[model samples]
Each structure stands twice: as structure tokens, then as C-alpha cells.
Target: MVSVTENTEQKIIDAACKVFIQKGMDGARMQEIADEADINKALLHYYFRSKSKLFDRVFVEIFSDIVKLLGEEINHSTEIIELIERMVNNYIHLIRERPFVPDFVLHELNRHPQLIVQQIHQYGMDFSKFQLLIDEGVLNNKIHYIQPVHLIVNVLSMCIFPFVAKPIIMGFMLNGDEAKYNQFIDERAGHVVSFIKSSLLINNPE
Candidate 1:
């Protein structure tokens, strides 16, 4: 049996997510969140003392999930290609289930860039695990000796930027055909992998 407090807390969190996505952090109102949760403002306050606190909770949760999905574990794993494949697939599924999450996260990130680095440190996330992978690739002459951060940024940009820029791409590039937009996103996953592989795989010079 769930306690009333637990249930109410969850309702508040859910409502906060919706309101944050729709109105952004600055624009969202406690009253709007309360109405969305179908609860009174006092109850909302009881669960979350302030809007900033509530937004921090949501931001941390969302940021942690994204980092976990894209962190060193995936970069350091022996089966990195397989890990990348699974991540792409899983991310796509998650996007399908929560289409608003990407836009919401990006909006918050634009509003508060430092929050991302702060959250990364708070989560104890470091990309050093990729150091070995990068070193091995360069040693074997498989890839250029570029900083791992650059590689990470490249891969993440390739994976996430399409979704982030979907509206512009669809509106101008694809003329706003919903199906075509989806197809473009679907193709991006494989294209990202292919691009990474091509960039990393070595060719013997004569």
C-alpha cells in the first residue's frame, strides 16, 4: 500500500514535469503545477518548498538519466559498438515514449548552461574511461589523436542535434511532413554509428 504522502509526492513530480516542459523553468507557475496535478497549491508546497527546489529535482533527475545513458560505462565497455547500438535504440524508444523530454531539457540547458556541469560533477561522472579507447585507437593508427572530449562531443552532437533541431529541419528542410521527419530521425541513429565507425576505422596507407 502506498502512503498518501508518497502518492502526493509522485503526483506533484509528474505535474512539475508537465508544467516545466510546457512553460519552462522561468515561465512555470506553482499554481499551474498545482492545477496540472489536480492538487491545491498548499499541497504542492508541502511536497516541494519552492519552485526552484522542485525544478532542481527534475533537472537533476533528467540530467542524471542522460549522463547515465551516455557516460563512460558505454564509452569504456569492450563491446562499445554494441553499447552504442543499444543506446541509440533505447534512446529512440525513450523519445517515442516522452517526446517532450528532449525539448524540455534543451530549453533548460540553454537557460542554465552551468547547471549541466554542476550536475555532472554532482553525479561524479567523468569521461576518463574513454581515455584507454582513444589511446588504443590512436596507437593502432585507427584514429587521429584527438581529445576524448572532442570525440564525445562529436558523437553526442550527432546523436542529439537532429532531434534538437527537428522543428527547424522539418519546417524548412522537410516541409513539415511528420512521417518524413520521423524517417529522418530514424535514419540518424544508423548514420551516427556509420559516421563514427568511418571516422575511427583505419585504412592502410600504401
Candidate 2:
């Protein structure tokens, strides 16, 4: 069970995320967030100090969290196929858990792309580990030679495009059946992994 303080904090964060995405940093107001969260402005200020601090928290969360998730999931893989599988599954689930995240990051990004670069620097994001895994796959003759960026883009595009285009996909493709839409999303990770592996693994000499 979530504690009251933790719940309140999360409420604040969620409200702030919505407001920031809807209004951008320039238009979002602390009182509006407080109203949305159903908390007084003083309490919101007590938790976040200022609108700059609140926006910073929400920005880091919506943007930096994915970078962190990718690092953790990719770093833990036992093999190249597992790495690809994990990336697809993990990212799809992340989007499922927080559908607004992609829109929030993309919409807010045009205003503050610099903040993303700062988060990357702050996190010391080392793709070298993931790169090393891919390099080993090539060296061991397990998977076809491919650039990390290509694979990264592949995984991200397959995982994120659905969420970015959710309304159209859910409306037209799924015909507004949310359950069917979720099922399609549920099946996507496996299909993506299979598609990638089929393209790459067929070249293996084994």
C-alpha cells in the first residue's frame, strides 16, 4: 500500500506532468497544478519549492526515466537475442504503463531539448555496455554485424511509434476497441523480437 505522503507526491507529479505537457513550461502554472492535484499551492510549493523545481522534476521523470530504464534492462541481458527481446518487451511495457510519457516528452521537447542533453550528461549514460554486447555477438559469429544505433532505433521506433500514434492506431486499426488495442500492444514485443531476430539470425552459420 502506498503511504499518504508517497501518494500525495505521486499525485503532484502526475498533475504536473499533465499540465506541463498540455501547457508547456512557459504556460504551466503552479496554482493550476495545485488545483489539478487538489492540493493547496502552499503545499505544492512546500513539496517542490517553485514552478521551475516542479517542472524540472516532471521533465527529468518523463525524459530521463526512459534512458535509465534502457540502461538497466540492456545491461542485464545474457545474450544478443535476449538483449533485443528485453529491450522490446521492456519498452513496450513502459509505454503501456505510462502512455502519456511519449507525448509528454515529445511535446515538451521542442521547447527544451537542452534539458535532455543535460540529463544524459548527468546520468553518465554509457551505451558501451550494450555496444560491447553487440560487438561480442559479431565477434562470436552469433548474430549479423549491425550498428548499435540501427538496433536502438529499431527497438525504439517499434516500441514508441504505437504510443505516439495511439489515437490513430486505436481509432482506425483497433476500431476504438481498447481491449483489442491492448492485445495488439501485448503481442507487439514478441512480434518485434521475432522480426528482428529473423532478419539477423538467419545469417548465422549455425
Candidate 3:
């Protein structure tokens, strides 16, 4: 059986996520969140104390999940290509299920970049594994000598931009066909992997 606090905390978090997604941090109202949670504002305060505190918890939880999937763990694996492919596939699958997450994060990051940086440091993440992978690939002649950060940024940009721009892409480009829009997003993972492989593959020696 779930504890009362656990149940109420989840309800508050869920309600806050929706409210933040809809109104953004600046525009979100405490009363609106309380109403959405079906609880009074006093209870909301008893649980979270302040809107900023609640927002921090929500953002940290969501951001930590994304960082774990996209940043920290992927770099720790030796099979860099396989890791990238898996991360892309998993991330696309998750975004398909929770499409609002990316936009919500971006909105908050725009409002407070330091929060993200602080959370990343707090999690003790280092990209050294990714750097080592790049070094190994270069030494083995499997990839050209380029900065790993650039490669990572490119890969992440390719994977994330479509989702970020989904509204405009679906409206203007796909004529608002939800099926076509989803299909396009579903195809992006494979397309991104293929592009990376093509860029990284070694040339045959004569």
C-alpha cells in the first residue's frame, strides 16, 4: 500500500508538471496548480512550501532522468556506436511517449541556465568516457580527429531538433498530419545513427 504522503506527493508533482508545461515557470500560478491537484493551496504549501521549491523538484527529477539517459551512462560504455544507437532509440521512444518533456525542459533552461549546470555538477557527470571513445576511434583510424564535444552536440542536436520543432514542422511542413509527423519522428533515430556512422567510418587503404 502506498503511503499517504507518497500518493499526495505524486499528485502534486503530476499537477505541477502539467501546470508548468502549460504556463511555464514565470506564468504558472500556485493556485492553479493546487486546483489541478484537487487540493487546497495550504496543502500544496505543506507539501512543497513554495512554487519555486516545487518547480525545482519537478525540473530536477525530469532533468536528471534525461541526463542519465542522454549524457552520463551512454558515455561510460565501451561500445560507443552501439551505445549511441541505443540511446537514440530509447530517447526517441521516450519522447514519443512524453512529447511535452523536451519543450518543458527547454523553456526552463532558457529561464535559468545555471540550474541545469548546477544539476549536472551535482550529479557528478564527466564526459571523459566520451572523450576516450573519440580518442580510441581516431587512433584506430575508425574516425577522423575531431572534438568529441562537437560530435556529441551534433548528434544531440540532430536527435532533439525535430522534436523541439515538431509544432512548426507538423503545421507547415507536414500539413498537420499527425501520422506523417509521428512517422517522421520515428525515422529520425535510424537516420541519425546512419549519418554518424557515415561520418565516422574509416576510409579503405590502397
Best by TM-score: 3
Show pairs that collide, candidate 2. none
Clashing pairs in 3: none
Every candidate's CA RMSD: 3.7, 3.1, 3.2
Q: What is the TM-score of candidate 1? A: 0.83
Question: Can you give the TM-score per candidate against the true fold?
Answer: 0.83, 0.82, 0.88
Residue 109, model 2: Cα distance from true site in angstroms:
2.1
Question: What lDDT tens digits, residue by residue, belong to model 2 across residues 44-89?
Answer: 9888888888998889877777888888886688687888888888
Kindly indicate the candidate among 1 and 2 with the higher lDDT: 2
Runs with alpha carbons beyond 4 Å of true place in candidate 2: 1-3, 6-11, 21-29, 42-50, 203-206
Candidates ranked, most accurate by lDDT first: 2, 3, 1
Give the distance in Å from residue 112's predicted Cα in candidate 2 to where it truly belongs.
0.7
Give lDDT: candidate 3, residue 110: 88
Error of 3 at 118 (Å): 3.2
